[model samples]
Target: MAHTPFKSVGMVGLGKMGGAMAKALVSQGTKVFAFDPNLKETSVEGVTLVSTLETLASEAGIIVIAVKPNLVEPVLAEFQKPAIFVSIAAGISYSQLVAKTPQGSTCVRVMPNLPLVANRGAMGYFCEDQAVAHVERLFYGLGDSFRVTKESLMDAVTGLSGSGPAYVLTFLQAMAEGGLQEGLSYEESLGLAMETIEGTLVYFRQLRRKDQNLHPMEVRNWVTSPGGTTIHGLDALERGGFSTAVRDAIRRATERSKELGKG
Candidate 1:
C-alpha cells in the first residue's frame, strides 16, 4: 500500500533528539511546526514555533512526540486532531501511545540514539503495517533504521543500539589511553583512535554491503597475522574479558528497559 508523505511535521519537544530531527526535516525541505513550553530559543532554522500542541496538530499531518516518557500522556491529551504520531520517547510502547491518543490514530514508537544529532543515528521502531512507510520516510536522512516484527524486541534494540554509543565512546577513551601509554601525546592519541574507529567502520560497512554473509571476526582475522601485534592485542582484550563485559552491559540494559516499560 502506498502511503502519502506528510505535508507538514509537528514537533512537540525541542531537546537534543527533537531539535536534531527538526533540523534534519527542515533540511529535506519539509515544513516543520515546533512547540516546546520549556524552550525560549531554538537553534534550528526553518521551523515555525507554535504556542501550543493544539496549534501544531491543526497544521501538521504528522506529529512527532519527542518529549520525555513521563510527559507523553499529558502532551497527547493536548492534541486536538488526529495525526500520524511518531514517538522517540524511550520505554514508551505503541499500545501506551495508542491508549493516550484519539481512537483510530496511528502510533509508532521509535528508539533513536544520540548519534542522531549528526544525521548518523541508528533507530529501531515498531508500528502497525499501515504506518511503516510513513515512519521510514520520517527518519530517512536521519540515519539507519530497523523495523522490528514485535514491539517487545524494541527493548532489546534499546539495550543494543540505543545504549551502544556510550559503550563505544568508553572503548574509544580506553583506546586513546592505550595510545597515550605508548608515548603518544593526548591530542594525537585521541585523534588517531577516533580516525581508526571511523575508518574501520566505513570499511566494515562496505564489506557487509558487498557480502552480507561476511562476519566481523573474518575482518579481524584479515588484519591479524600468524603472530602479530593485532593478535597480541586480541589476546590482551580476551584476558581482560572485553567481549564478556560488552555482552553483560547489553544484557543489563535490556533488563532495565523491560522494567521501565512495566512502570
Candidate 2:
C-alpha cells in the first residue's frame, strides 16, 4: 500500500524556503513541526515550532530537509527510521542520505526554485524505489513534479528549472528598466513586463494544446514583421549574442551542479 497522507512535517531550517514550505504544508492540512536555530518568528496555528532538530525529527512521519547542501549529511545522521525523507538541497544525492540515515530508509532529492513558495514551483525529484510514492504524494502539493529516471540528469534539471527563475527574473528586470527608460513609469513598466511574460506563457501553452511543436524562432517569426521594431530588437539581440550567452550560462550551471553533486 502507498503512504496515503503525511500526518506531520518537520522542517529543520525556518529561513525563507523552509518558512514558505511550512506555510504550504499547513495550507494542505499537514501539521508542520518547524525548527530553526536562528528563528525570529513565533508559531502559526497549524505549525508547531520546535526548538531542536532531534525533537522535530522524532515527531515527524515525513521530514522535508530544506537546509543547505553542506548540512544534509549531518542532519541525516540524526534522522530515525519509519519516515520518508525528502530533501530540497541543491547538490545532495539520495545515495548519501540512504547511507547516512538508517539502511532501507526512504529518500527523495528534489530541486525547487523560489517560485514554489507561491505553489507555482517547477521542481524535479528523483527517488529510490522505496520512497518514490511517498515523495510524490508529499510534493504534489508544491507544484509540477518530474520524476527523473537517472540521478545524473538532476544537474541538467537544476540548470534548466532550478536556476531558471533567476534568469527569467533578471530578464524581466532588464525589460522593465528599458521600458522605464522609454518614459513609462516604474510601476507601469514592471506591470507591462510581468503581463508580457505571463501572456507569452499562455500563448505557448495554447500552441502546445494545438499539437504544435512551436520553436522559439518560429514564434519570433510569427511576431516579427518585415523591418519592424520587433525585428530590429531581435537583430540587436542576435548581434549581442543573447542566445549564445544563455546557452553558455546553462552549460556552466550544469557543470557546477555536477561538481556540487560530487562534493
RMSD of each: 1.9, 2.4
Clashing pairs in 1: none
Clashing pairs in 2: none
Clashes of each: 0, 0
Q: Compared with the true structure, what per-residue lDDT tens digits does model 1 show for residues 54-159?
A: 8898889789999988898888987766778999887888888998898778999999999999999999999989998898899987899999999999999999
TM-score: model 2 vs. ground truth: 0.91
Q: lDDT of candidate 1 vs native?
A: 0.90
Cα lDDT, model 1, residue 51: 90
Highest lDDT, which number? 1
What is the C-alpha local distance difference test score of each model? 0.90, 0.82
* lDDT of model 1 at position 59: 88
